[model samples]
Target: MDIKPLLLASGMIAATALAGCSTVGGSVYTASYASITDAGYKLPAIPVSKVPEQYRRQIVSYETKEKPGTVIVDTTSKFLYFVMPEGKAMRYGIGVGKEGFEWSGTARVAMKREWPVWTPPAPMIRRRPELAVYRGGMQPGLQNPLGARALYLYKGGRDTGYRLHGTPEWWSIGKAMSSGCIRLLNQDIMDLYDRVEVGAKVIVK
Candidate 1:
């Protein structure tokens, strides 16, 4: 056997594995660039090409009894789905709460806001004094933790202190890193914000 042939085979195998690591599915590639907007405040427009293929917004075959317009969050899989008729859904990747902060329940979107303000809760401020500066509420802008939009969650007519909101940290789209809120990429959340209504149902599991 020629040693050169064996060396070429090994190189080919290594190259195949490296390429697979960068892809979410067969023939689908992640996005490479994004656009930014400066309408009053700087806002980012995430390119569909920059987002991973699986995370990009798409209509998918989903089985659920929930009516169209309902939002379902599957924390384990890091996906959020907006149910539609005919067994379909608009699915987007999400960033969920960290280990001990995870929650599951039914709630309703009680309010919606664009470029929402963020106020560090008392407990959170106590845990990290640096957050105390935002106790009165941080102004809405690119650096705001709430990003470009927010849908406030409520249960039994009371605020749950949980939210479905956008994040400036686009890289966190498929991770478990939020305090307790359900987070989406800024562009995705902006799209979701337009479709979801104040009285729409939300299921988190």
Candidate 2:
């Protein structure tokens, strides 16, 4: 059986998604990421070929002392690992904060939300006055910075003002971007949102 047609179709899907010239449906990487509607918001397919394979979500033999249900963010490597039982982890590529904006600490998933509203922090607005227009909170939608899901972080019962959230900029994964949030692709974050519970331990390193 000739497989050239299958390979060519996969290539076209990636190209169309990358060029943003067409709606992308299933081809390759469909099991991991395909365009979908979540909470009435349509998320475009991610051209996962443009992202390194290691950054794609996969279950790996990750040895860690952290108990299951803990989230470990490896800042240097741009990876987020959700600890599972039996010395394994569900690892996903992530985008972290830039230079001075990097944060490292233990926190809890204080809250979880679907299609979360985004309000620029006061300090952020101070830096970019144009965002003052959103001081009242930006309504949730596809264009929202928080994307399809957000896991708010807190420590010692106080809001840490950081979040593990989804981002529309899937290309930014495996890189240092964002102000301080840990951002993942829409599909990855949606998977995480369902797996992670509020009060899950999060260690950012």
Candidate 3:
């Protein structure tokens, strides 16, 4: 009956029920999500028990007409799928735009960066003045919102100012919390950064 749809509509209940729905072997998930040393920072390992099974990265049967290497972000479901051959995909949990910031559209990965600098957009700075200090851009580091990797999104060669990036706030997954960009676990994003190339298609829905 697709109860997950209804559960997702109720955040509190969904958190409990979804956590009980499915699970993975500790060894496998633990290994895949182990701490990483990137650009001189030690990314901590994820606490597998705190991550719901549905949100963990895994391969699943995905029926999509999109070609392999395409990226699809289902914001409502907090999932990002990387399409693969044979109607399959590597799905990762994501944090989407919160409230008024929600957005949807198709774009192309215009660029990819590791430990990228972060500069809050003008509007965002106007809303949160403290970010104004970063008008010149925040240096990349563990505390950077872009985390370990970032894939800049553009449409028709115009920068959309959106990105598929990593976040240190791992607990934000499966929730709507970002300003507009899609965020994944640092571990997951580092892995994805290696797989996706600049110019790949990205569909946000």
Evaluated with lDDT, which candidate comes out highest? 2
* Rank ordering of all candidates by lDDT, starting from the highest: 2, 3, 1
* lDDT for 178 (candidate 2): 90
Compared with the true structure, model 3 gives a TM-score of 0.85
Q: How do all models score by TM-score?
A: 0.81, 0.85, 0.85
Instruction: Quantify all predictions' global Cα lDDT against the true fold.
Output: 0.83, 0.88, 0.86
Off by over 4 Å in 3: 1-31
Instruction: Please give, for residues 22-138, the per-residue lDDT of candidate 3 as tens digits.
Output: 232321122267677877899998886798878888777789989999999999889999998887778899999999999998999999999999999999999999999999999
Query: Model 1, range 108-180, lDDT digits (tens) per residue?
Result: 9999999999998887888799999888899999889998899999999999999999898888888999999
Predict model 1's lDDT versus the native: 0.83
Better of 1 and 3 by lDDT: 3
**Tens-digit lDDT track of model 2 for 23-89:** 1232222335778987777899888779887788877778899999999999999999999998777
Per-residue lDDT of 40 in model 2? 75
